[model samples]
Target chain A: MRAIAFKEWLKLRSWLGFMLAAHLVFAAWLYLSIRHQFRFEHAEMIYYQANHIGRIFYDDLRYIPLLTGALIGAAQFLPELLRGRLRLSLHLPMGLAPLVLAHLGIGLEALLVFLALDLAALAITIGSFFPAAFIGSALLTAAPWILAGIAAYFGVALTLLEPRRRYQAANLALSAGVVWLCHRSGQYQAYDLVLGGVAGLVLLLAPASLQAAHRFRNGEP
Target chain B: MTSRLLSWLCLAFLTVVLAAILLPAIYAMAFAPRVAPTHLFYSAVKQDFVYREHRGNHDFTYATASGEHFDRKAFEMSLPFIYYKNMELWGLLPIEIDGQSFDMQAIRDARQVFELKAREVADRHPSVPVHALLDSDPGKAGLSFPEDVFRMKPDRMEFLDVDENRVDPALTDRFTEALAAERFAFPARLVAGKQTILKPFDEGVFLVDAEGAVFHVKRVGDDPVIVRTPIPTDLGIRSIKVQENRQRIYLGLVLTVDNRLFLLQSDGYGLVELPSSGYDADRMDYKLLLNPVHPTAVFGDGGTVTAVALNEDLLPIAAYSRAVPGTTGMIHARISKLLFPVTLSLGTGNSGYLGWTVSGPAPLAFLGNLLAVGVVLLFGRRRRIAPQQMIPQLALAAIAGLYGVLAIALLPGPGPATGATGG
Candidate 1:
């Protein structure tokens, strides 16, 4: 496990660092932009717009986590598949399921760290102007977007590691569908009721890459 | 084995959910329903109910319930008060209707139009609970957005100044004491106000307290005017919509849990219940048209529009309903029912929240499921799969219908092909 972790760290260190830097930059940008709104516009009107008119100040942050997850996914798996390193990794003493899960698990941990930072930045920014109530609703609104990040990470892994072209296309389409479901509504706490279903999809997609790894090992076309 | 099965199940789940969401949308887009807006009114001149239906090709049909047709000019002449401007424009005013004459000025003052949509009743959007109370008596400066917004907490009323973003203790205590004097239950359930500078004046805020008692709160020249209304506490009020009109006859409209309509009459805060028949607030759009003579309440669902006219004493005088053509019987609708066994809804027209509801047209859906099973069997045969290997796919198709078939076809099942047995 340590050897695999070391190898993953060697491959992912630069990407992870770049992602962390980008996330910090995004957090600062979010804080400054919202602060600019408060400084120029009437804070009361802003609150009214957010509460009544369904205006989302943090809408730009919606797709940032998605991109982060996708980039981390490509960084972790594309090289391994291209260099046929995954084939040798499968020959390791570890079980195939654990090996595939370990790869996905590492990428997921990195994505979660970024998502947590994104959420923290959002909470602090909204908290600066609005009350604690606004913070809760803002986080709830971002819940599905956060789920989209997790789904994208698993989806990229599944698509990249799949042996066949058609199955890869299938995985890609399925992943897009799940992401679309996550972003179907832009309202605050819109998906609060159905968030469990989305979380269930993330749980399912986590173990899904194992099947693709098994198919690759069998040399299935 | 469990992991492989879970993976297969995951694929199937994704397939079904996506297909269920997308297929119906594509079907709806292909066979979009068209319904014309029909306006219903009470013809005080004829002492009957009438409707003007806007049909396709710019065709308009004006008629009464007894099949009495009127030309465009005559239709406007029938409801003199409603079309008072048109009547005056065409030199048809001063005509006596039920022994009363209406000038444009009188009609304009008496005219009240209130539209209630299903989405408003659903309250899907999270509105800032803090309300900016416009000074009801803005005297010279007119109605303006106040600096402080007040929130009705469970125990007391809290005021927050927008500029400082801090609670004003003096203002909060003053209003909280006023509400307390009225014996108001501390926790508020519903607070309705028109928070805009667009209206003629402000009616303050109408609140339903913890015990469902109604109270009116407003600011008039730095003094808080609170009135505990005479509305019964057990009224089970579902929603309250406040409209500050020029007439000052009524403050706003109230919808009860049983779908009854009541006017919050300004005279001593009395409740006047209107006669509503076949009105489901959850599924219908409401239009209450108040005139000096006969007041009419029209409720329109997708398929039909029903209107009830009330006499001066607020008694139901006449009722009329018109059927609006819908797409339920259209060819595409029939085809959709035959192709898709179940409908999956994420967001409904009535509510703002996103939820998942799976409703199947059972018995009719069974046919679609059977057809899906047949298609899966053919695909299995083409793949040279053994019968036992096809069991799970066939069963899923039988249950999820077309969605299941799409899922299984899009996602490969776990395990190797059983083609060796066939060979």
Candidate 2:
């Protein structure tokens, strides 16, 4: 398990770093834009516009997390599945379920770590110039974006392992449903409790992939 | 087989939620009857409820409750207080009201309006309860966002400067001291401020302290002035919205714990609770139109409009709740109830958010569903399909109604997948 975890980490480390750097640079850009509005222009003006008018400055990073999630998930699973290397992974000193979980678990860890750092950057850059409540709302708004990223991970993984195109389409469509569910609310904190449930439900995607893996192993297409 | 079944179960959960939200939306846009919105308002001068609604494309009809009809000019003249300038231009304005010459400027000056939307009330998230106050003193000619907003602690306050991104220790201490002198309990509950960039002048923020005491905090040029404003302790100030008006009669609006609305008196901290009969947090829409004669408030479920007339004292003189004709498509609602087992909607009332609610087709939805099943069954009987295969179809048709029947009809499920599964 340790060897597999380390091996998976090594494979994902550079991609993880890239995701982090990209997100950090993006967060920096968002900060500079807001800072520009505050310094040269009246900071108070932007503050009121944000609270009253419901215009968000961080709209650029709306799908960045989703993009990164897809990339990381594809990188982790596609290379293994494309060469039928998952068959080899099935023989790795563990059961197929636990082994597959280990692979997904490591990939998800990288995604979560990068997301945490990204959220922290948002807090510092935007938080410095705003009150706690405004910052809290902004973060809550970002929750769906982050969830979309995670959903993308499982979605890409499942699509990679599915044998039939029909089943793969179903996988993608349903996964999109979950992501869309997270993003349904524009009101702040509207989905806070429900999103936690959604996050737990996304784990089911890992177990769900077992069916696809079973088919792929048996050449069931 | 188990793995496939499990996967389908999970997928089913997600698909149902999606269908619930989507199918209804699809049905509403495509099948629902078109409803022309009716704009209704009561005119005091006309002494009749006025309504103007579109009769057809690019056509409208204006009417009054007394069966009087009006053209655009007469319509404007009828609500003289609202369209006073237009009435004056057309010479339709009565020179005298109750035999006394009316002052147009005075009427305009007395007009005031404040609106509350359910979305606005639901959208607030806790910010770091820090506030920046501007000096309302005439010596300070312009209004600007404060350099720093202050947060109170026990025996202390901290001012975070936006530009510097650091706490202004000295200013914090000065304000803290002033607040202490006024006997303001530390750690405010509700701190309301007009955080707008450009304002006529600063009206400062209102603060409710830990002990439920209200205090007015302002930056008077170079000095800080904090005054304890008395408010009823039991009022349970849910929210404080500071509305800075030139009149300066009332400072802000307060939403209380008991769901009552009050005008925060600018003369003092006294609250003049509005005569709200059925105003609740769930109220989808609220509109306050301050005509010269009286203020009118309309609350609605996004379909029905309840209009309230307020007298000179801003007390409710009379209020009538009426559902606007064609605001909701009656035929569509009835038809939809029959087609769907339960339709998913984002929100019909207010606070627009995607939420799952059970909505079945109405009118004859159950009957509509039965008819659909009957058609499918009649076909199945002719095809000589096994009774077992038809059971799931009938079951879905019964449960999900029209949507389910349509799904089964359009895309028949691959009865059961065969082939190597967990082989």
Candidate 3:
């Protein structure tokens, strides 16, 4: 298990580093924009705009996490599939399930770490300008977006590893629908009621790649 | 075996979710209802309710409760106050009714509009937990934003200075003591205020305390004037809306848990209930139009609209209702129920939260299931799937209907019959 995880990391470390640096740059951009707003405008009026007018000051960060998830999934899996490395990996002494589990586990852990950095940036920036209450609301609002990042990671892997063309297209459609639902909300805390169901659905997608890997090993199209 | 089961469950869940998202959109695209805008008003001259059904731009149909029809010119003359500009242009001003005369100025001053839409109800969107209290008495200069905003806590109220981004301990203690002096309970449940300077004046904030008592709190030149109203502690108040107009006749509007609407008047903070029968605050849109002589309350859903007019004494004078043609009885609507058993939506008109609602499948959906199963059987025969593999495919189609059929078509078994995986 350690060797397999190390192999995955060796392939992903440089891409992961690039993603971390890019995420920090985005966070810094969000922080600077907020500071600039406060420097010019009356703080009270800006507060009223956010509270009453429903202006999302940090909307620039909304799609960054999604892009990070998709790129990292591609970096980790696209080369392996193109070089037929996944076929050799499946024939290792370890079983197919263990091999697939290692790849998903490592990729998911990395994606979560990146998402956490984005959330922390939001917390520190919002807390600097507003009260602690605003921090809580900001986190709740960003929860679904972060969840979408995770779903995108799994979706890329599932789409690439599937054996047939039609099933891949179907998986792509289903995954896009789920991601769109996660991004549908425009206001703060809009998904609070059904967030648990959304998390459950994302969890169900984790094991889906294993079925595709099983078919690939059987030489099925 | 566990991998296979998990995969099947994943496919089933994805299939249902996709159907819920796609089917509703298709159904709406194929068959969505069109509704015409209708406005109701009370004619003091006729002493009855009259309404205008707007068919399209520059096209209107006007009728009264007594079956009297009117053209565009007659309709404008009937509701004189509504079209007072036209009345003035046509030299029909200074109309007398009920032993009183009203000109354009008098009509403008007495007109008050209170509108509540279905989407504006409780929990529809998130609000900032803290509120800025505009100075009610700005003295000469005009109303300006306060330097600090206040938040409600369980035991007391806290004030935070926006510039400093910290609490103002002195102002917080002062306001908390004022509320405590008036016996205002801690941890306010609902707080309503218009945090804008665009209004004529600031009436401050109206809040419902934990004990269900309503209180008015405002800032007057660096001091807080808190008044605890005589509103019943058991009114089960749902929400309060504060709009500061020029008249100062009322404080704001109050909605109760039992769907009762009331006016929080300024005359000693009296609660005057409006006649709101056949109104559902959660689903229907509400509009209250107040003129010099009467107030008309209008409630409309998609299918039906009802209007009730009241005298100055707040007694119901007459009521009129109209039925709007909707798509519920249309052929496409009934067909959609048979095609898609359930739908999933991210947000609803009544709430900002995302939720899943599964409508019970109609009995006709069984026929859809049967047809889908037959199609799957034929497809499997063409693919030459073994009897063992075909059973689950048929069962999925029979149970999940079109969703399952689509899933089966998208994902078929391995190329011939591979016994098992070498891995």
**lDDT tens per residue, model 1, A113-197:** 9999999999998888776678898999999999999888888998887888878999899888888888989787888778998
Q: Where in model 3 is the C-alpha error above 4 Å? A: A93-95, B30-33, B36-78, B83-101, B320-324, B386-388, B413-423
| Best model number under DockQ | 3
Query: lDDT per model, in order?
Result: 0.82, 0.68, 0.81
Best by lDDT: 1
Q: State every prediction's TM-score relative to the real structure.
A: 0.91, 0.84, 0.92
Residue A204 accuracy (lDDT) in model 1: 78
How much does each candidate deviate at the interface, measured as C-alpha RMSD after superposition?
2.5, 4.5, 3.1
C-alpha-based local distance difference test score of model 3: 0.81
Alpha-carbon error at A168 in model 3, in Å?
1.9
Chain A TM-score of model 1 versus the true structure?
0.98
Which has the higher TM-score value, candidate number 1 or candidate number 2? 1
Question: Which residues of candidate 2, in runs, are more than 4 Å off?
Answer: A1-14, A17-55, A87-99, A127-138, A184-194, A197-204, B31-38, B52-74, B122-128, B138-140, B152-157, B326-329, B346-349, B352-398, B401-416, B419-423
Candidate 3 docking band = medium
Question: Residue B373's C-alpha lDDT in candidate 3?
Answer: 80
**Which 10-residue window in model 2 chain B sums to the lowest lDDT?**
B414-423
Model 3 chain B weakest 10-residue run by lDDT: B414-423
